[model samples]
Target: MSLKILITGAAGFIGSNLCEYFVSMGHDVLGLDNLSTGSLSNIEGLRLKDNFNFLKGDIRDIETCRKAVLNRDYVLHQAALGSVPRSINDPITSNDVNVGGFLNMLVACKDAGVKKMVYAASSSTYGDSKALPKVEERIGKPLSPYAITKYVNELYADVFYKTYGLNTIGLRYFNVFGRRQDPNGAYAAVIPLFTKQLMNKQSPTINGDGTYSRDFTYIDNVIQANEKAMLTVHPEAVNSIFNIAYGERTDLKMLVDLLKMSLSKYDKSILNIEVIYGPVREGDVPHSLASIDKAKRILNYQPQFNLRDGLDEAVDWYWSHL
Candidate 1:
């Protein structure tokens, strides 16, 4: 059956991808974006679809959030200020958007009686924990302001379920990257940023000798997690947090090598591009890997793309678009 869905950050890379996927599946998708970091170009394709509608609004405003949630069957809340560096530089603004805005969305969803909300939680919530293959049950203290905001999201979602009877699921995304991700922003994700630079034959900088690693999940895997979280009928899956990842770690050096090898298919010159070493970034974890057992057992999430496959697809998109 078709449903009415509201995607809070519909103009962003992940949110726009969600809008397109849901719209393609014949759902009535209402996209609300403040355009602070999200670009309209990302969702331009969806604008032409009859099943899609977009509202230019900020999540910080209660009225805007309420308006967006009203009559919506489900809410996929993806609006938040991302990037550790960005949050470190502007903690106040990040707090307002990530923490304040998220609270507003939860209230709106509860008051409007939305069936469920699947929000974009961050892996940064595992901060300072030296554990490998992070499990859903254990988490360490957050290292950055951005991490704190995302951790708070989980707390709020849990309380909403326990107190107000709102059904909510949180997916802790690990280093998500793929097509439509912005490679030009100052705080751009590593994959897209490195891919763009390598394609242009420029030396991309790798912080701290490039030994730091990440789970590096693909965008499709994230989309799959969101869909499963939103539509699943499994009683055990609702109102809990799950790690959405490919369950494998790749170091920065290996990541650059893979990107070069992938892009070299289009232009062999990229293989020879060198990387510059720099100081380690603040708030960066040494390594990150996830135990996707909870998500798989509950949500039936089966990621189709691994690191190499995802990189190839992402490289192709960036080569054509950038």
Candidate 2:
């Protein structure tokens, strides 16, 4: 049976990808985005599709959120104000959009009788724990305002499920990067930012002595987790948080070198560019690596793209488009 779905942040990098995939699968997809961080050009192609609908609105507005959820079978809640530094500088707006807006979506999803809400949680929730291969059941105190908000999201999801019988699956995303990820922002993700810098023959700066590592998951893996979370009938999967990652770690120095290698295929001059090291920014974890055993056992998630392969593909896209 064809399902009706609502994807928040549908104009964003991950959200637009989700919209395209689901719509192509013959599902009716309604996309809601305020276009703050998301660009309309990301989904302008889908706007012409018959089964795809777009709503220019904000999730902070309960009325708009309620309207978007009407008749939708599932809600992919990806709308949020991301970035640790931004959250640190302006915690109030981040809370308003991430926490308050998240509540509105939960209420709308609950009121509309939506089946499941698969949301984008963050690996930042792992916080300050020194544990290698961070697990779902074990977590430490939040290290930043952004981390606190994401942790709160998981808590809220649990409460909603227990109290009102709402079904939700939280995918704690690690350093996700792929096509459509914006490289032009004060808070741009590492991969895209570095890719753009190399493209421009500019040196990409490394924060700290370049030892900080992250799981650095590809976007496709994240989409797979969302699909599994939405359609899985497994009784144990609902109302749980799963780490969505490639189950590997690459440090900043290695990441830049690998990125340089990929970009060199297009412009060999990029290989000669230097890397500048700077002081570490606040609210950043020293290292992050996910233990994907829980997601593998429950969601049956097998990430196809490791960092090198995913970076090659992403570099190809950037070369052709950028």
Candidate 3:
């Protein structure tokens, strides 16, 4: 059955993809984006669709949040100031948008009586933990302002669920990358940034000896997690946070090698480009991997694309678009 959905950050890499997926499934989609970090080009294809409605608004405003949640069956909240480095640069702005804006959305969701709200939680919430595959129950102290904000999101969601009876699900996303992800900005994710540099015959830089690893999840896998979280009828699924990842970790060196190999299919010169090594980033975790057991048991999430599989597609998109 088709549902009425409101997707915050609708012009962003992940949110725009969510908008497209829901619209393609015949759902009525109301997209709200401030376009701060998001680009309209990401959702340009959906602007002409009859079932898709675009609203230029900020989630920080209570009125905007309330308006967006009205009469909506489900709310997929993805708007936030992402990037640990950016948060470190301006912790105040990150707190304002991520924490303050999140509160506004929760209050709006509660008052509007939205059936369910599935938000983009972050794996960075597992800050400083030495565990190999992170589970939901165990977490370490937040290492950065961005991590604090994301962890706060989980706390607020839990409170709203218990105090106000709001149905909320938090999907702690791990290194999500794919088409439409910005490759030009200082805060651009590693995959797209590396792909762009390699495609331009420029060398890509790796921080910290290229040994740092991440559970690089594909965009499609994340979309599936959102969809399942929104539609799940199991009582255990609602009002709970689950890790959305591929259950595998790939180091930076391997990641760059894979990108070069994938892009080499389009341009052979990409294979010869050397990677530069630099200082490790501040507040950056050495390795991140997620235990998807909770998500699988509850949401029945099965990630279809592994790192190499998704990298193949992502590299192709950058080759054509860049």
Candidate 4:
């Protein structure tokens, strides 16, 4: 069955993928973006599609959010300023966009009487805690401005559900990377940034001693989690947050070696590229692993790709495009 869907940040890496996936399913999908961190080219093919429409707008504006979210069946909210370093550099702007804009979207959704809003939450919400496999119910102090905004999102979502009966599901996304993820930004993700550097015969830099590990999730896995969160009929699935990841962890040193191996298929010289180590950036946790048992038991989410499988595909895409 086809449904009306609103995907904010529809021109971004994750948002664009959601837009394309839902559109392919023959749903009436409306995409909203400000083009700040997103690119129109990401959804360029869908530009002429019959059922997909793109609205150039920001969620910071209540009117814009209300206008875009009106009459939507479900909203996949992925728009946000995403990066600890970027947030640290400009905390004010990050707060305005992440917190204020998130509030605007919630209000608009409530007013419009949307069905359910599945938003992009962050794993950084589990800050300062030394837990190995991060559980949903337990969280630590937010280590960065970006983490605080995401945690605040969860709080607002909970209040909206209890106060106004607004149904929501938050997915605390770990390191999500895949095709169409920009590799040139000042805040580009580790995988893409490293892939780009290797493709150009340049070395990739490691922020720490290459010991910092992460639950590197693939974009497709995230999409699967979103769909389940959006469509699940299970009563317990709504008004909850789930950690969306592969349920595995990989250190930076292993991550770089895998990247080199994946890219080596295209260019053998990539295997020779050395990794550079530097001082750890602020607000970075030494290790991050997710307890996907909650997601799997609740949403029945089964991630299809692991780090190795996804990295190969991502390398292939970057090799051809970049």
Per-residue lDDT of model 2, residues 246-276, tens digit only? 9999999999999999998888889999999
In terms of lDDT, the poorest run of 10 residues in model 3 is 313-322
Q: lDDT tens string, model 1, 38-64?
A: 999999988999999999999999999
User: Measured by TM-score, how close is model 4 to the native structure?
Assistant: 0.99
Each candidate's number of clashing pairs is 0, 0, 0, 0
Task: For model 4, state the Cα shift of residue 105 in Å.
Answer: 0.7
Q: Tens-digit lDDT track for model 3 on 1-322?
A: 8899999999999999999999999999999999899989998999999999999999989999999999999999999999999999999999999999999999999999999999999999999999889999999989999999999999999999999999999999999999889998889899999988988899999998999999999999999999999999998998899999999999999999999899888888888899999999998999999999999999999999999999998987887888
Tens-digit lDDT string for candidate 4 (1-322): 9899999999999999999999999999999999999999999999899999999999999999999998999999999999999999999999999999999999999999999999999999999999889999999999999999999999999999999999999999999999999999799989998888988898888998999999999999999999999999889988999999999999999999999889888788889888889899999988999999999998999999999999988988988898
Q: Model 2 — TM-score against the truth?
A: 0.99
Please list all clashing residue pairs in model 3, or write none if there are none: none
The Cα error of candidate 1 at residue 207, in Å, is 0.7
**Reference-based TM-score of each model:** 0.99, 0.99, 0.99, 0.99
The Cα local distance difference test for each model comes to 0.94, 0.94, 0.95, 0.95
- Model 2 ranges off by over 4 Å: none
**Where is model 1 more than 4 Å wrong at Cα?**
none
Q: Which ten residues in a row have the lowest lDDT in candidate 2?
A: 313-322
